[model samples]
Target: MPEEMKTLVVTGLRTQFNTAKGPVAAVRDVNLKVARGEIVGLVGESGSGKSVTGLSIMGLIDAPGEITAGAILLNGEDLRKASPKRLRELRGDRIAMIFQDPMMTLNPVLRIDTQMIEAIRVHDHKVGRQEARERCRDALGLVGIPSPEERLEAYPHEFSGGMRQRVAIAIAMLNRPDIIIADEPTTALDVTIQSQILAQMQKLCRDTGTALIWITHDLTVVAGLTDRVYVMYAGDVVEEAPVEDLLDRPIHPYTDGLIRSIPSHNAPGQPLNQIPGITPALDRMPAGCRFHPRCPRRTDACLEEIALRSFGPAREARCIHPLVEG
Candidate 1:
């Protein structure tokens, strides 16, 4: 895709947290791009730095956790160099984030309408209160909320967990942002609710031409939802390809393990397949390839530092001995 088509682009991103020992990197050398109306999956196991990457792009990393190095471009705007005031102004207006917990987006005391309307008008003061309320209603309706006008009057607590998440999605869409980074937004919902939300998100993106970066550990979700996938291990993105290509022929050992671990891939009554070892702690991360310790394909060659190697267009794996050929 051309540069103009990309709504968000992140390059050489390194986010670190100041720990008791020293500064430990949570996200390292991450590069991602999401074009208009595209859904890209950032997939990995827990503690893989997916959330930190999302936070870094949104300029939400606070004290003790700073973006040490990166160029976060939103429609060509350099977010890393942007001032705090500019970031605040851009957050909800041009880019938004849907967190796993709806509470992160909602205020307990406020009614849904109040929150959603405020979310809109805060970015666009020129919009009338009535217009904002109408937009909120439409946004709620867009996300499949029933009786949106009446539902808007209810507090966050009045809605069920799924409903609250829907409201959160509604709020994120209020301003029709160019990009929305969803950090496991449906992880807490039931399987059925999760599917529903995923479908809704797809339709919303298609309708509004809004790009989305869905940060999740679920390969199942990625198979069904994303156009392309980036597989992360520890803090590094080990693989990147179109969703089908990655799932069908993963290059990195870690990416292959993740795909095999999906329940549907195993026969009935068989032991659930899983990656051999636990993710390394940030401070205690292994030298060279972070996943070498647990990798079935590990060799002495893996002990040496390896960088992401390109196979073909949009295909990359950070491994010396990849599982498949170009």
Candidate 2:
């Protein structure tokens, strides 16, 4: 790797759920690399293992759902083999995750100041209470919270939905973690708030050189927020490329369908093109190419297992019949 490339490498990542029927492969043979200060978008439909992949990276997967095989490397260090104590030290200090639901990270019973102060103290125990309180207030200001001192004394429920989400984002930023895995942190907010939050996050990441993994089902969101995009389906990555390249010249059929499904480009009265068929259940994955059943350009060869191959400089696709310009 080059001096500028501080890569977070993930190879052969496989997460399986132990069910009564059999093992359910939620994520299979997934490989990805997020370099320093790079924002990588992981886009997929519901139950497509996007969130599971993020959780696995953060070492938050519970029993019954386990990362069966994989190497999660952060700046060349393998996090998978790290001890629980080491992982605990890393979480919220070196790696933080902002979930879709603000409540998931926020304690409803505690005031915002209490939660944020505790977070600051966890990483910087030598700081006095007043200093921690000031740091908490500054973190809140960084996320665009108005009247930070007053807001800190309020409960989580006191804030509006969008405000609560912003506060959650503020908490994630309190530690200035090197990597922040945001799993649709703005999905619940209105358009205005979403845009504001996205802008703030982008600016913060750029200024601080924080690598981000933003997982969402919205192509539009990814287009606006990420430097690159990775499309996943049936627990496998179907396409990966620069954001502009992936959006403008998507190689995989699934990627094309997703681009076409976005309603923003449709005419005043034209119906948006919607990709039919739900993602296959984990235990019921199709024989060869998991996406063949739903692909428009699928052929008999698509019924054979197709591994991801290089398509361009820093771009890859797993489709046998990838689209190419004549």
TM-score of each: 0.98, 0.96
lDDT of 2 by residue, 1-326 (tens): 55336657888999999999988999999998888789999999987889999999999999899998989988777899999988988889888999999999999999999999999897778999999999889988988999998999999999998889888888888888889999999988899999999999999999888899999999998988899988999899888899999999989988998888877767767988877787888888998889888887888987778999998687999887888632
Q: Pick the candidate with the highest lDDT.
A: 1
How far in Å is the alpha carbon of 160 misplaced in model 2? 0.9
lDDT of each: 0.91, 0.89
Question: Tens digit of lDDT per residue, candidate 1, span 1-326?
Answer: 78756898899999999988999999999999899999999998788999999999999899899888979989999998999999999999899999999999999999888888889888888999999899889889988999998998999999999999999998888888999999999989999999889999999999999999999998988889999999888899999999999999889988888878888899988998888879998899999999999998899988888998898999999998899986
Most accurate candidate by TM-score: 1
Q: Model 2: which residue pairs collide?
A: none
The lowest-lDDT stretch of 10 consecutive residues in candidate 2 is 1-10
Stretches of candidate 1 off by over 4 Å are none
Positional deviation of residue 51's Cα in model 1 after best superposition, in angstroms: 0.4
TM value for model 1:
0.98
